[model samples]
Target: MTDPAAAQAPTTVLGASTPRTPPARLGVAVVHDLVEAIVTGEVQPGAVLPPEGVLSQTFGVSRTVIRESVKRVEEKGLLTVAQGRGTSVNEASAWNVLDPVVLSALVEHDDSLGILDELAVVRGVLEGSMANAAAGRRTAERTAALQHALDHMHETIDDFDAYSQADVDFHFTVMEQSGTRLAPTITRILFDRARESSRFVGAPAAEALRLTLEEHQAVLDAIEAGDAAGAQRAMEHHIAEAWARRRLPTARD
Candidate 1:
């Protein structure tokens, strides 16, 4: 049984502001708060949520809004709603990490940077496979386009923003040449999400840009030579090493 006192959610925990969430977006606000609370461990796994009446009062929304919001959180694998026992947060392992809201919350709260580390590993594997496929499927035109992207990166090496974009262009060119739909889509989503995290965008030293240029050149050479195995290795090495160079050390490290 849940301790009665534990069920009383702090009003601030629900993100109740002085003005309160407008009725039009009460459900969304409630859901966002609940997810963040669960993800950040403000609400621990197996802790019962407050009763519907308490929640409605705390959030200043109707009981109906509370029910709907809780249901949405349950659907995201963050909550287990027992019929009579009340809703409880699930373990982090149960979360839908790919869900945009869940992913955003995880990234925002990732103080140790473990999530970004895992993100890099996943990107390296997926991008390596794509590079391999691109090598096999490369036509003269596709190879030329990739070379052009590499050239742009070289030209813009002094301009961080331009070089960063060109780097993305180089990767996109390879993914496009692979002609695989699902993998590219998933990779793009993960890549975009990681890029949004400041922890994943640590300051790059001038030497870092030079090293990146060298890495890109290696990948390009392997792909242009149609060395599928070599391309896969080059792409994987670049992603993993690039992330290592940028990853900020935490106390946990």
Candidate 2:
């Protein structure tokens, strides 16, 4: 016969620990899939989700799973649930685009050009500020990292995908050197938009690559020389050139 008191003793001895078991939350994964579908416009705003019973049956899970998934989507501002009414998709503005799920949605939506342009504008502002700050605050190590990225860009000059990735890295490095949270966050968001655009992966114009490399060099030189004004101007020029290269049709033109 086992002693009830001995059996009741804590399994974890003072500091000795039991193996940690990972959480078993599949709700987040389900929520992400649904949210992604909505953001990509596969399920437009105001579109109702399948009934909870249907979702549970389809996913081979319980109503608790469905409810948890819906709750997660609601927290991301992608879903709306009511007592009598069903769950429906929310507007694009309701989403937190900086959230990775939202970013993926923006990329998946083929017609997200408008949002991409808006993102570019925001990026210009953020990167410009970061360049200026880096000019003033950059250490030797950060400057060296920028130079290395530039070298990588040159080496991959013939590879559009590689070159574009290096370009993103160079800008991100500058923002990191600025030692500020906001700039890095905004730069990341901008790069996410760029990746979604998918315009830089194919055969890019040689002229475009040359111009971009030169622009990056200019920004690097300005940052290295500690020329804040020059850095800001160079960054703005680089971004403007990229915008123009995208050949995005304006409302008037």
Candidate 3:
């Protein structure tokens, strides 16, 4: 028994609100719109999408473009196309959250900040393990490089942009020192995506830079001393606390 009011609720049409997407980028635009629609729950799980013809008219694209774009979205694990039935959205558990397009949409449209909070938890676990590994495998050269990165952060502490990059460099150094390829690669993807979202990089506390610097120092000291447990705890705490400081409050009713 679907509510009549809910059934009549307006669906968000990206093309209606935004400037026209360029002809050359129609496919990409369509895919982005579809992804955004699903991620924001404009189209809920199990809801069959409108026919290709309808979507074509809605997006001002040819039926072929709409078909292709739907396929692209399907490839990202957001849709299921079946014979004798229209294309339907899959559940969130079925989504390929690592896909850049999917991930970006998830972060950008996360009104409740739940996605970012989950991101922080996953990052804390992964980076904590990496930091533990780094402590066990630290070399003099690697330690020196990490020290230099921290020094650069100190030098650029007053410059937010520069300090941010230096902060990335320091983390990169630690990940590289850990000598595990896959974890670093995946962590980088997650970190990069989160950093790119303004919501995830929300207003920071006044002592943000100083506190961040101190946290980095603690991580470095633990790693340099080969204190694996200490390094792991320090790195986990830093990520968890950093996200807490920057996480924005969602608008309430």
Predicted structure with the largest TM-score when compared to the true one: 3
Better of 1 and 3 by TM-score: 3
Model 1 gets an lDDT of 0.88
* Residue pairs clashing, model 2: none
Best-first order by lDDT: 1, 3, 2
Summarize candidate 3's per-residue lDDT along 88-161 as a digit string, tens digits: 99999999999999999998887788889999999889889999999999888878998999999999987788
Better candidate number, 2 or 3, judged by lDDT: 3
227-249: candidate 2 lDDT, tens digit per residue: 99899889988887786686545
lDDT of each: 0.88, 0.76, 0.88
**Residue-by-residue lDDT tens digits, candidate 1, 1-253:** 9878756855557544332544468899888888988998888998999888878877788999989999999999999998898888898899988888888888899999989999989989989999999999988999999999999999998888898899999999999998899888888888888888877887899999899999988998998899999999999999999999999889999
* Ranking of all predicted structures according to TM-score, beginning with the best and ending with the worst: 3, 1, 2
For all predicted structures, in order, the TM-scores are 0.88, 0.74, 0.90
Q: Residue 232's C-alpha lDDT in candidate 3? A: 98
Model 1, residue 65: C-alpha shift (Å): 2.6
Check candidate 1 and list the clashing pairs.
Answer: none
